[model samples]
Structure formats: C-alpha cells, structure tokens
Target: MAEGGTTLEFTPTWVVAVVCSVIVIISLAVERLLHFAGKYLKKKDQKPLFEALQKIKEELMLLGFISLLLTVFQERINKICISENWLRNFMPCKKPSDDKDEGTTAHFQTFFSPPVLPATVGRRLLSEDSSAPTYCSIKGKVPLLSTTALHHLHIFIFVLAVVHVTFCALTILFGSIKIRQWKHWEDSAAQKNYNAEDVLQKKFTHVRDHDFIRNRFHGFGKSVAVLGWGHSFFKQFFGSVTKSDYITLRLGFVMTHCRGNPKFNFHKYMMRALEADFKKVVGISWYLWLFVVIFLLLNVAGWHTYFWIAFIPFTLLLAVGTKLEHIITQLAQEVAEKHVAVEGDLVVQPSDEHFWFNRPKLILFLIHIILFQNSFELAFFFWILVQYGFDSCIMGQVRYIIPRLVIGAFVQFLCSYSTLPLYAIVTQMGSSFKKAIFDQHIQEGLVGWARQAKKNKGLRKAANGNSAGSPPGAAAVQMTKVREEDALLRSQAKGTEIVTDQRSNSSS
Candidate 1:
C-alpha cells in the first residue's frame, strides 16, 4: 500500500477482505434504504417498492457483466504489456554508476521483481506518476509511455466505448419504436372488437411459420432494388430490416402478455405461444441447423474478446437465473390456479397475491447476493478505468483505489435510484392502458348479454300468453320450454358474475 508520494508496497490480504466486506455492507444498506423509501412513498394503487427494487436488480445484473468484461480486458492488456517488457519504461531505475555496491543490486532486484499487485493495480501505479518514486533512485526513470502510444491507446479505448454506447442507444431506439408499433396494432384490433386471444394466437402462428433465412435474403434483394448499386449500397444492405427481425419482437409481446388483458394464464399461454416455434426450430434441415449453430458460435466469438472465458460462466449463471424465474412463475401460477379451484371463484385472494409478489426467501437472497457481487466488481472496474487509462499502470495507489471504487459504486446506485420515478410512471401508463381496454371489453360484453337476455324474456312471455289459448299439451310444452330458457339464463348470469368478480379483483 502507498499514501501520497510514498513507496509502493503489497496490499495485505486482510485489507482486501476488509474492503470487500465493507463494500458489501454498504451496498446492502443502500438497498434497504431504497426499499424503505419506496415503501414510504407508495400510494394506495402503486407498487413503488417492488418496481424500484426490480429496476435496481436489473441494472445491477447488467453492470456486473459489463464490469467483468472490462476487468478482463484490462488484465489482458496488462499481460501483453508485461510480456513485451513495455512496462519497464515506467519503472524507477538508478543512474549508471561505476560504484559496485549491495545497495545497487538491491535496487535492481526491487525494480525488476515481479509485481505482486493485481494487473489492474500494477498498471495504475505505473501509469499515474502522481509523485516522485521513493522506492528507488529516479535519476534514470523513463517516461510512463511514449506520447504516440499513450495517445493511440487512449483514442482506441475511447472510440470503443463510444461505439458500445452508440450501439446500445440504437438498439433501445429500435426496440422502443417496434414496441410502439405493436401497441398501435393492438389498439386498432381492440377498437375493431377483435378477440385478444385470437390476435395473439395469429401472431404466434406467423412467427412460427416465418423463415429466418428466406426473409433476410428477400429483404436484402428488395432493399438493393430500391436503393440501387451506389454509395448507399452497404447502408441499404445493413439497414434492411426483415420480417424475421420482427419475429422475436412479436413473440416477446405474445409471451409476456395477452393483448387487451395482461393478466391471463401466463404459464399456459407461454407454452402454447412457444410450442409451434419450438417445433419449427427443431424440425429445420440438418444443413440449415448447422449453419445456425455456426452463426451463433461466430457471433459469440466476434462479440466477446478474451472475456469469453468469463462469458462462459456468466452465460451459465444467466441460464440458471432464467430457469429460476421460470420455475417461480410456474409455481405461482399453480398456486393461483389451486386457490381459484378450491375457493370456487375467479378472484385471487390477497394471500395468493402476496405469495406471487414475494418469492421464496432463499431464492431471493441467492439472487441478491449474485447481483451485489457483480455490482461491486463493476464499480471496482469502473474506478480502475477512471483512474488509469485502459492500458496504464497502478503501482502505489491501493488505498486511494479502494475509496474511489466505493464512491463509484455509490454513485451508480444513486443514479439508478433516481430513475425509479420514471420507471414507475412508464409502468403506470402501461397498467392504465391494459385496465382501460379490459374494462371497455367487459362493459361491452355485459351490455350485449343484458340486451339478449331481455329479448329472450320478452319472447318467452309472449309464447306463454299465446299458449293460454292453446290445447293442454301445447300449454304444457310452452311451460317446459320456459323452464329450459330460465335455466340457460341462470347459467349465463353465473358466468357474468364470474367475469365481474375477476374485474373487481384485478382492480383491487
């Protein structure tokens, strides 16, 4: 460890452990604070706490992966520099002297010795010449790095970061636009009195039948024909969005919620929505399947650099997380179903709702732990990036680095926390839309049924009046017909009551 302008020394293992423990404690405290604040600010109809926590959890998950990648990237760069002896240029060395002494040998040994610090810290120490070296004579110390190398590396990393940010921005933009389009289509269908289930089933069918490869080639040809062979050729080529691009988008809507009514039988809906697509994927030709596999491999290789080693385990973790979410959803659905059956009602009880909202304690804790670990690592990596350039060194700044890492993590949490209100607003708007559509549909159905029942009753009364003048057998037949009609009306009334109960439950 080192203070301002002091000699660099190996940071004690205990110090590292203590710092990590403190970070974890601080993170947990912040989470609890956010949770309490959300609870305090919650309204009668809102779920501010759940919404805030969910957003934070998602942000942490993303940051964790990003942090791991950046950390690994920095490490790889450090290894390259070390292997090429490029770091030696930054090391403090003694001036060439004619005196042959033990002090000189010791200085040389210390200067050339393998760095005990982690690659990130070692690189930071070397790059940041905040103070004069106190460990060895600095008479022959070289510049940290050549001006050309420094500028090039800095520019390269800056560009890479910019590109990454730009890509993410574009993806979000396109996704939002697609979602808006889907909402518009849904609204149009609702206005025209289309059945929500039918619309969703039709979308699933289209997606299932879509040929991923064929659409790409067809869209490419169409784009080329429209744009012509000119300077815009490549632009048109890449910018040509196909039907296949929309497949996943459509599937997302279908799997997540039904149009008009969001609270449907989600587990069963997912199975039905995915069944055809799953079969289609599994039934693809062998050569095409091989192509798909190769394409996926190539994509993974191209996107992930040396961090693929980390990516493998992260990917596995993601799979596990996804499976856990699925299991939880299924279990909740089963519980809800059982409750409905046992109670002989469509309304879900408050207890069942609580169970749905609050998942198993152990599962939740494990997830939180994973998220916290990732978030801490990400913050530490971010601090390193800020203090030292991507390819720079850290020789004597362990104490400073730890504090900066903690500050960085805190800042990130605050930033995420600030977005809670916006997320809540957006979610509220979506809920309002679903509720509005559901209410309208229900109202129309009830009105139509009421009119039909009134008309049937009037007709039955007219038949009874006419039967009073007919033969005994005819009069008996008319009475029996009225009884059947009454039974049918009773069943319809019961069905309508169930719908009303469901609407009330949903509103609550």
Candidate 2:
C-alpha cells in the first residue's frame, strides 16, 4: 500500500482473512435441523405461523451473514468505494468526502484514510497521448452515504428486486400446487366451477410475466405519503443489495415475446417479413451472452479483477434490457388494444410512458433519449476502463500500451458490431410482430366492422320486411340497439383477454 512498494498480493489466504473470523457452520446447521424437526412435529393447522417464522428466520439469517460481511470489509472496499471521490464520480450530488467520520474526534477522523491504489474505479477515454503515464490522482477519506437520493435509488432497485424475486418464487411454489389441485379436481370432471385449463394458464402466465418494476414503482409511489422516511428503512432492508438473478425476469419476457414472431428466415430473403421474429429474442440473447463472455474472457486474459468491475455494464444490460423489453411489450399491447377496441384499461404505467409510447414521433424521440443514455453508459464504462488503464498507466505498469489499445479497439469493434446481428433480429422481430398483429388485429377489426355492417344491413331489411312478423319500427329499433351494444362489448374484449389468457396459461 505504498508508492514503489510491491503491490498487495491478494490470495485465497488474504480473501479468507478479509472474510469473517468466526466460522460457526456446525451450530447453524444444528439449529436449522432442530427448527425443522420442531415444525415437522407440529400439525398443519398452524402453517401460517410456521411460514411467518420461516420467513423471519430467513431474513435474520441473511441479515446476520450480511452484517458479518460488511463488518469485515468495512475497513476495506466499502469504505474506499464509498469514498467522496468514488461516490461523487458515479453519483452526481454526494460529497466527495465526509464532513467528519462517525463518532470520531476531528483529531482522529482522518486516522484511517486507506492508502488508495494509483487508479480510481471508473474508466477513462482513449485519445491522443492515451498511453501516457497516469497515477492515482484522488486522495482523502470517503464519506458514508448516510444517506442520499442515489442511496434511495439503489435502495429502490434493491427492494424491487427482492419483492420481484419473492413474488416469483411464491408464484412458482403455490402455483404448482394450485395446478395440481386443479388437475385433481379435473380427474373427477363433473360440474367443475373452475375451468382448469384457463385457470392454470392464467396462474402460470402471471408468474412468468410478473411486472417487477411497474409493480414496485407503483408500490413505492403509493406508500411514499404514508411511510415517509420509513420507506427508506424498508429500502435499506430489501433494496440495498441486488443479485444477478434479477435478470431471470428479462429472459422470460424475451422468450414470451418470441412466441408471437413470424416463422421464416429464408436463405433467399433473410430480412423477410416473418423471419424477423426469430431474431428479436436473439438480439437480447446476444447482449446477455456478451456480458457472460466478456466477464470470463477478462478473467482468463489475466485481468481477473475486471470480471466483477465489468459486471456493472453487464448487470445494466440485463436489468435495463428487461425493463425496456417489458415497456415495449406493454406499449405494443396498449396499441393492440386501441386498434381493436376503444374500451380498454389503457393506463400506461407512467414511468414507461416516455419509452413505450406508440405514436411515431414519440418513438423517435424515445430513440434519441435512449441513444443519449446508451452513450452515457458507454462513456462511463470506457472511463472505468480508462481509469484502470490510468492506474496501470499512472503506475507506469503498462507493459505494452500500443498493442493493448489495438487489441482493445479490435475487441470493441467486435462488441460494437455485435449489435448488427441483434439489431437485424430485433428490428425484424419488432417489425414482424407489429405487422402480424396489425394484420391479425386492426385489419381483422376493420374487416369485422365491414362484415358486421353488411350483416346489419341484411338484418334491417329483414326487420323491415313482412316475413319477420313484427312491427317494422319496433324491430328496427331493437336490432339497432342490440347491434350497438354488441359492438361496444366486442370492442372491450381484446388485450384484456390476451393478457389474462397468457397469464393464466403460464402461471397455471
């Protein structure tokens, strides 16, 4: 941790040392076994208590482990990463350093300023003199974010993730049981109040396509007034941490959307109408795969440290991709509703309004906004790389700068170009989906309207004619009123059924 001193050798021993000192694996196992045995001895009548107890146990166990981890690393990564320079760099408003360390004298507050490495956390850009030596320019202590808006945002995402995961897991467990119950009921197959297939489908579909973000956002918004600062407490408990599993939602969404795409990508017409649907999920898959691959490649290529650091972008791609995919699906679904029928639960989730608007101009505007966001993301990542490069550069540790840049540029070109394949598929998929739905829905509605109009004309004629055996005026009036009501009802029943039907199918 000194200039001109050998770099700190981080090894398994060092890692173990950094981890908690007291390992009580046997005691925890024994306690868990005893708890399980006690539950097994009890009758099933009091399951809710057991369930609640189990949940509490889980939470406590989690808190205990996390507390220990944080305590161990409190003097290392967290303190440094939360340093004033670090937070200010990523999070715009936070102070670079704290006013004073917690419960410390002004004399001793500065006592534990960890010796930072030569480079900062974020990367830099590649320009002229990029190879020039760089050093750890930043100094001083980090301020604890106790706490700020970014903390809230992080907390929000974390809580969202937890609730999302919990909901999903619950759906799977309970839903499977529900399906079996329905199946058992179906075996008897008499006067069944439940449509087993429909109910099952709805249950499964609901599980599959759970809207984690919108639900959490709405949940947060509703509770904001009542909870006051208490909201942050929940956020800290549930949202302060995120795991990669949050991605499982997006992968499912992509697959769900893929079900509706067109069938053929002919050798003759690779970009043909239906062929694009096949590629839509493929595009998303590429990014997901890219993240996995890049992380490993970096690790194997002697930049093992880069794996976790690069995860920020990988995690962003997974998370944001899921968020955006859901947004786009919803927008299309809404558009589907508007085209086929006027009476709709057309409440667009407000957070998604900007990105998921169906209007052409709105989409273009959104595209620009997304581009800017993407650029910022890339720039920040590049800066991270640059910062690392600068760490190596500043430390004068770079072995061969020019060669590294060439290889890096070449790799970036590949990464940047990766979109061509995904874009081709996504564009094809999105457009194909639009076209198919357009033809199947809007066009179908128009044709139905024409057919209905014709049928009404025939009915009117019949009503007016003597063969109907009713007064002409009364017959016409009744027919007209019935037709109007039918039309309205028919209009209200489009995406509502589809969403409901899909949810039922998947969750069941």
Candidate 3:
C-alpha cells in the first residue's frame, strides 16, 4: 500500500507472456481448423455447410470479444512491467517525490526493487550491502505511462489478435458467398441456350465462350462494388456516370440533339478517364493511422502488440489486390467484345514484348505495391523511434531499419504470392492495350449510349411498322411479293417434311 492509499503489486511478465502465447497458439489452431473445414465443405459441394460454419465462427468471435472485455475489467487495476528505465523520462508529468527515499536512481530502483528485469533473480544478488549506495541515494525514475494505462494495454493486444483473425475469416466467407451467386448466374445463362435436338442446334447454341471468363471475373467486379474502391473508375470508363451532370446531361443532350456522327471524342474521354482513376487509386489508407496509435501505445508500456499492425495493411492490401485484378478482367471483357465478337474462345495471344518485362508497366506495378504495402511500414519505422527515444529495442539491437526492411520484404513476398495471377492478367491487358493503341483503335467497339439508343429505337419502330402496315408498293406488286414469300415458306415446309419421312424410313 502507498502513502496516499493507492495499492501497487507486481504482475509477472512471464505470466503475461504465457497467456499471450496460449492465445496465439489457440487462435492459430482455430484458424487452421476453420480453413480445413472450409476446404472439406468446398470439396464435398456443401456450400450450406460452409456458410453455417461461417455463421458459427462469427458468433464465436462475438463471444470472444465479450469475454475479452470481461477479462479486461477483471485485471484492469494491475499493470504488467515489461521494460525498465526505457522511456521513463518521457512519461507524462507527475508530482515530485516527497519521501525520505527521494534521490533514488532509476537503475537502483528498478534492480533493487520487486519490479526487476526478466533475467534477474534471487534475494542474495539484489540485496544491498550496508556500505554500498541504495534506492535512497539516487534520484527517482519517471514512468513511461500511468499504471492504469499499462494494465489496459495487456487486454488490448490479446483482443486485437483474436479480432484480426476473425475479421479475415469473415472476408473469405463473404468471397465464398459471391462465388455461389456468380456460378448460379453463369449456369442459368448457359441453360437458356442448351438444346439436345439437332434441328434447332444452331439456333440454340447462343451462349458465348467468353461468358465463362466474364463469370470468373465477377468476383473482381463484385469486390470493387462492395468496397466502393473503384466505382468512379467504372463509371468513367463504361460511360455510366449517374451523378455527374457533364456526363449525364451536357454531353448526352448534345449527342441526342445531333443524330449525326459522334461530335464527342471517344479517344479524349478514354484518356481523361484513365487519368482520373489513376489519381484515386491510392487514396488515404485509414488503417495505417489506427496502426500508428496501436504501435505508440505498445511501445509506451512495453506491451507485446503481436504484429497486429501488419494485419490491417494485410487486409487493405487484399482489398487493393482485388481492385488490381480488374486489369485482367477489364482486358478480358474488351477482348471478348472485340476480337472474339462475344462468340469465340476467350484468350489473348501475347506479344513477344509481353513475355519479357515491359519497364513502364513494371514501374506502375511497383508503384501500386509500394503505395499499398510499404506506406504502413515507413509510418511504423519513424513512429518507433519517436516512442523509444533510442533507436534500439530492449535487447540493445538497433531497430530503426529492421522493421522497415523485414516488413517490406514480407510485403513484397506476399505481393508475389497473392498476385501471381494478377501479374499474368496485367501482362495480358498490357499486350491487348499495346495492340489497340498501335492500331489507333483504343476506343473501338466501346458501347456508346446515344448511338445505340437511336439504333434500338429505329429497330423497334421498323418492327412496329412491319406488323401494323402492308408492304409499300402497288396492290398488284404487293400481292405478287406476298405470293413469292408464301411459295418460299411452302418449299421450306415441304423440304422439312421430306427429311422427316427419310429419317422415319431409315429407322424402320
């Protein structure tokens, strides 16, 4: 008990370390089990089973958070001592010591007292000799943070680890749900054009091969839509901007007002759209800011934050990775629409340049990777120095460059792992884009609103007129034309009847 009626007790670091280790091991086991179950369900074609598991995992995560909060309250008053003499002077202002032991030095106070470093042990070594200097002889040491704040830090780290894994699982589960919806649409669309009979085979074979490619990239599109990450990009390129008045009204009204050849420059529009979307690609990453705060708190109290900082950026990188996937997807759609004519095989024959690296595209890829991955690493690099005052960890190893280097390497590694397909897809797009640009057909085959609407309107009017009116001619000529069409229809019917008779006779 303190002189001012406050209680102080030492909670062992080894105990906190043990608890953290147990939580980490359990969390990993749970994650691996969930992953195993997910793969099993997927293999067995049990979507409902996987979905039910997702629901259970979500429920468990909630309970875990509740239990974590309860645990925090149970131990909120006890602070764990992790570091000594580090950041002691930088702690917030406190009242001066008024006791007989006022001049006690930090090294003596830390080593001589109960809150000794982790390696120190035994009363024989710690006990002071009567001739030697003691706690009373040295100045008092400042704390890095309030005792209460340190108590809360332990709970924060544990909860952060559990919650991070849970949220990642939730992301994967959401992706799985989207995959089901895509398959349903693909199968339904394909079923419409399927026929077993030969007579109508040509007429019923309406499904395009590129439809498979389109369905596969549906996740890429859905992710962008759900995250609102690249909606504006789609709006500009696809000529589908709803809220932009210049796009919706001015250009549209002018195109409608003049029914002639396009006065609007499609080439300029594509260039501007690309430029606009480029600006929005790497917008502010809010998760980086949250990480900075977490890291600062962890350093102040010497608490083990358990690399939860990397977790947010990992998730963010996944989201950005999903967005980058559009490079492959958009190019596939373009190829399907143009060269394939929405009917042929959905494949791009890559140019010689595509097999070897193109420096410009490589630079763009690096820019995106660095912006998404290294931005967080650099933030933590400087912030660690700010909190610790020294450029080293507790073990006296210089850490200024280690985290940045190690994290950057891991990020680069993950980028390669997560985006291998993305790289190949981007290469395909680059090849296609190069050909399109060389041929001066960058905007070729792009659907336009005004022209297509007019063409559709004309088709509808012609259909209505044909059903409502007689063929335009003298009555005799019109009758003669009708007689010719009747004769042609009779001949086709006769030919079909003869073929049916031949088939019946052969079978008999």
> TM-score per candidate, in order?
0.26, 0.22, 0.29
- Prediction-by-prediction clash tally: 10, 33, 6
What is the lDDT for 105 in model 1?
20
Off by over 4 Å in 3: 1-139, 143-150, 189-294, 297-322, 328-508
Which tens-of-lDDT digit does each residue in 1-508 have in candidate 1? 2332232255567877898999999989977886776666454323322343444444455545555564445434333322324443333322223224322221221223332223223333333333334222243333333322333334433333333333323322343343344333333322433344544443322221234322322223446434322312232223222233233223333334433453332222222222212222112134432532343233221132122222332333343333332332232233333432221111111112222244323332332223333333343245335644333222113554455445434333321221111111112111111222234345566677678778778877877788868888987887787678778867877786678558633542
Q: Model 1, stretches more than 4 Å misplaced?
A: 1-33, 40-178, 194-383, 390-497, 500-508
Put down candidate 3 lDDT per residue, 87-181, tens digits, no spaces: 34332211124233322222122311224222212222212232333342343443333322343343333344344333333333343333233
Using TM-score as the measure, the top candidate is 3
* C-alpha lDDT of all candidate models, in order: 0.36, 0.34, 0.38
- Backbone clash pairs for candidate 3 read 103-138, 103-139, 104-138, 104-139, 105-138, 105-139
Tens digits of lDDT, candidate 2, 37-63: 557734543332344445544544654
Residue 332 deviation, candidate 2, in Å? 32
Candidate 1: Cα lDDT at 54: 47
lDDT of 2: 0.34
Of models 2 and 3, which has the larger TM-score?
Answer: 3
Which scores higher on TM-score, 1 or 3? 3
